[model samples]
Target: MAFSSDLDQITRAASGDRQAVSALVNRYSPGVLALATRMLADRAEAEDVTQEAFIRAWKALPTWEPRAKFSTWLHRVALNLCYDRLRKRRDSTMAELPERVDMALRPDDALDQSERVQAVEGAIAALPERQAAALTLCALQDHSQAEAAAIMEISVEALESLLARARRTLRTVLMERSEA
Candidate 1:
């Protein structure tokens, strides 16, 4: 969607325009769902997080500034919701490490490729929160460093550092997994 159209829709939505709100939801839900699904690794929980993110966006629409892309700000909202869920899981009495999913691919595809992908995803989920967020925004979602930094509420330098550490950690974790 074009920026002008987005700006107009957001502006209208903030003023209680139902159609504008629906348009915005349709435009952004997939991205939000992708982010949440990647972060949470559970489709049901990710769907809940995505819905909560949209509800939060509706509440915050009136105060939203158009200085940044609506998608960027929406990502911030979605990610924050992911963080909230992750935090709750961490604090739970029965909290345990995230489980691995056995990826089933086509019969013609290589099993090694599926194993590598699963290992990488498991490594990502094992990362420290900030490192995971940095990698998710910069590597997975293709957000520029500057845009990611703004969404993460960190300096560009800090974001880059997090990315570097995340990459290093992922490599180490994956290597260990392979050796085991």
Candidate 2:
């Protein structure tokens, strides 16, 4: 149903239909933004990646062959952009200074919950890129295993392996944090 709807919208969008383009953006922008945010851990960078992905999508629409689901292809594009950014980070020689946490400040329940969420996100951000991507797609975003696998351009088994490793690492990291 989504596939067909997307195809219709894509067709309309290809012919410079503003409503169709708006509909497509409204439908997919949040998802693209979320995926980029999870992958990059930087809201600004994620927004940039989302905008770039849409720009690329618009360009491709005219010649777009429906070889893969539009969502899958768009996600792959976003993921690749993420990979490029990650690579750039790795290539840079400067080490980023860690943000200081004020452990001295006591927190209310809401602040505690916020801290917990930050902990989990920090753990996820520490993961290897592929593992992080798998966990983000499957666990955070609720994508089906098949869809996540397609987006990552990996076999389902490979995706499962990455997820397993990510889960294990998160468990260990969170447990250690709790103990501290």
Q: Number of clashes in model 1?
A: 0
Cα RMSD (angstroms) for every candidate in the order listed: 3.7, 3.1
Leading candidate by TM-score: 2
48-87: candidate 2 lDDT, tens digit per residue = 9999999999999999899999999998999999999888
Q: Residue 172 of candidate 2: its Cα lDDT?
A: 74
lDDT of 1 by residue, 57-151 (tens): 88878987888888888889888998998899888855565665444333354668757566566668778878988998889886788888988
Full-model lDDT for every candidate: 0.81, 0.84
Worst 10 residues of 2 by lDDT: 97-106
